[model samples]
Target: MRVTVLGTGAMGAGVAQSLLREGHEVTVWNRSPERAAPLGGHGATVATDAATAVERAEVVLLTLFDTDAVVDVLEQAAGDAPTDAVWVQCSTVGVEGTETVVQLAEKYGITLVEAMMLGTKAPAEQGKLTMLAAGPAEVLERIDPVLRAIGAKTVRAGARVGDGTALKLAANAWIASITAATGQSLAVARALGIDPALFLQAIDGTASDSAYAHTKGESMLAGEYSAQFALDGLRKDIGLITDSARATGVSTTLLDALGRVYADASAAGHGSDDIAAVGTAFTKD
Candidate 1:
């Protein structure tokens, strides 16, 4: 399988490396040429532009930051993409933005699959991320092997383009909500003079135990603010959840509240920090 990966960020490079490990011919492109250099030694070609990278690839994986970045690259590659190419959009853009990609791909007669991954950088690199995919059944079938190379599990939400995006937003909402609750609860525990470790241990003993909570709890305890998922990114995902819920006539008060918490964290200058830093927002002065 020939693969072209755009964006070359942590997630993008990780995906490219996964493909290379699978013996696929992978070409990677980043806006800053230097960002793509690290992949060159991995037997992956680095392209100076999106068009050149995507030109001859059978599968194009987009792990861009947001919808705007995705549009910018596609616009630059307008007339150069192979007509029968399969575009796997792995970014977690909102529903409306994903629908636009579907429309544009249809206009170009290309196969577009909405593939939003669950898990962060390490899992992506280890090919253990879970992929939520939706699009034409034929397209999913054609790319099953490629998807399997990067994901340990792939769930087919439905055959609609935005279905995958919706599923991603809902999943992210759960992540944000649980993270916020954990952060707030730990703050209360500290206020009452309970050790954070004991609080985590107590929680881990119950049915409320979850991988998401454990990971965030450990990060919070250690005060690690690395960008596994940046605060601003979670803010964006929460906003998407609110918007999608509203569009579908669903109540989004909890999501809205979580979005505000993240917005506050970003406003306090932690936007680029990992979302686990939300714990700091509840700290005493």
Candidate 2:
């Protein structure tokens, strides 16, 4: 497959590397060309412009920050995409945003698939993330091998544009809510002189154990703030979840509260740190 990956950020670069390892011809483009440097040595061609990146690719993958960024890139590449090419949207945009992308792709006669991933950069680079996919059945089948190369599992949400986005938002809401609760509980435990490790062990012993909890708990205990996923990015995802829930007349009090915590973390200068740094927001010396 000739693949073009837009927005060469952490996840984008990971996606590109995964595809390259699978023997696909990969082209990478970022608004800041400097960001594409790490991918260049990995057999990826860096595109000087967005349009040039999409011109020759059979599949275009988007892993941008938000809906607006996705739109901006697509608009810039409007004239360069081949009519039969498939546009795989792997960003974590909300329901409305996904719908808009569907419309734009239809207008341009491009096959569009909403593909939202369910893990961070490490898993992405290892081709071990889970993909929530929704779009035309044939299109999904056509891209199954490429998706499988980059994800451990590909769950078909439905054959509709926004279904995958909706599922991703719902999954992220659980992630944000659970992470917030874990951070607050750990803060209380530490203040009461309970060892963080002991608390984590007990929690992992129960049904409450989860991958996010374990990973983030270990990071909290070690004070490792590496940006596997950044605070601001998680904040944006939480906002998208809450907004989508509200638009659909669903209640999301827990997600709303988590969004506040993320916003506070961002405002307190931890925005660039890993999202697990949310623990620092509640910790008191």
Candidate 3:
């Protein structure tokens, strides 16, 4: 597959590398050339612009930040890309944004698959991410090789373009909730002069145990805030989650509160750090 990946940020870069490892001809572009430049050494052809990147692409993956970035890049590159090429929309741009993407695909006559990724940088780098996909059976079958190169599993949300986006938002709502809840428990334990490690110990073999707790909890304990998934990125996703929840009458009470915690963490200069930095919100004076 000749794959072109736009927006080579942390996640996007990993996705590109994973494709390269699978022996696909990969072309990458980023607004900041330096980010994409690194992939050149790893067997990816770094394009000078989005338009050039998709000219020979068999599949174009939009791994950009938000709806606006995705829209901007697609508009710039659509004319140059093959109409038969599959555009895998992998950004977590919520349900409303997916509708906009669907319209763009129609306007340009491009085949689109709404495929939102699950898992952070590590999973993306290892080709272990779960892909929540929604599109026609034939289109998905056509891009199965591309999907296999980037994800460990492809979960079919439905045939409708927005179905994958809806499922992605629901899954992200749980991610934000559990990460915040884990941070709170750890913070409260230390505040009460209890060993936070003991909290992990207590839940080690219980029904309440979660692998994610230990992943983020240990990072919080060590204050190693290097981003696997940046706090600000999760903050953006939380806002999308709240908006989707409110629209569906799903009660944004918990999500709204969690959003505030992430907002505070971002405001406190931890925006570029790991989501474990949310623990600071509970401990701050």
Task: Name the runs in model 2 displaced over 4 angstroms.
Answer: none
Model 1 residue runs over 4 Å out of place are: none
lDDT of 1 by residue, 1-285 (tens): 888998888788888888888888999999988989999999999998999998998888889988898888877874687877888998888988897787777677777887888888787888888999998899899988889888999999999888888889889988898888888888898899988777788877688787777889889989888988888888988888898899989998888788778887888888998888888777866
- After the best TM-score superposition of candidate 2, give how far the Cα of residue 149 lies from its true spot, in angstroms: 1.2
TM-score to true structure, per model: 0.96, 0.97, 0.98
Ranking by lDDT: 3, 2, 1
Worst 10 residues of 1 by lDDT: 102-111
Candidate 2 residue lDDT tens string, 27-67: 99999999997799999999999999999989899999988
As for TM-score, the candidate ahead, 2 or 3, is 3
Alpha-carbon RMSD, candidate 3:
0.9
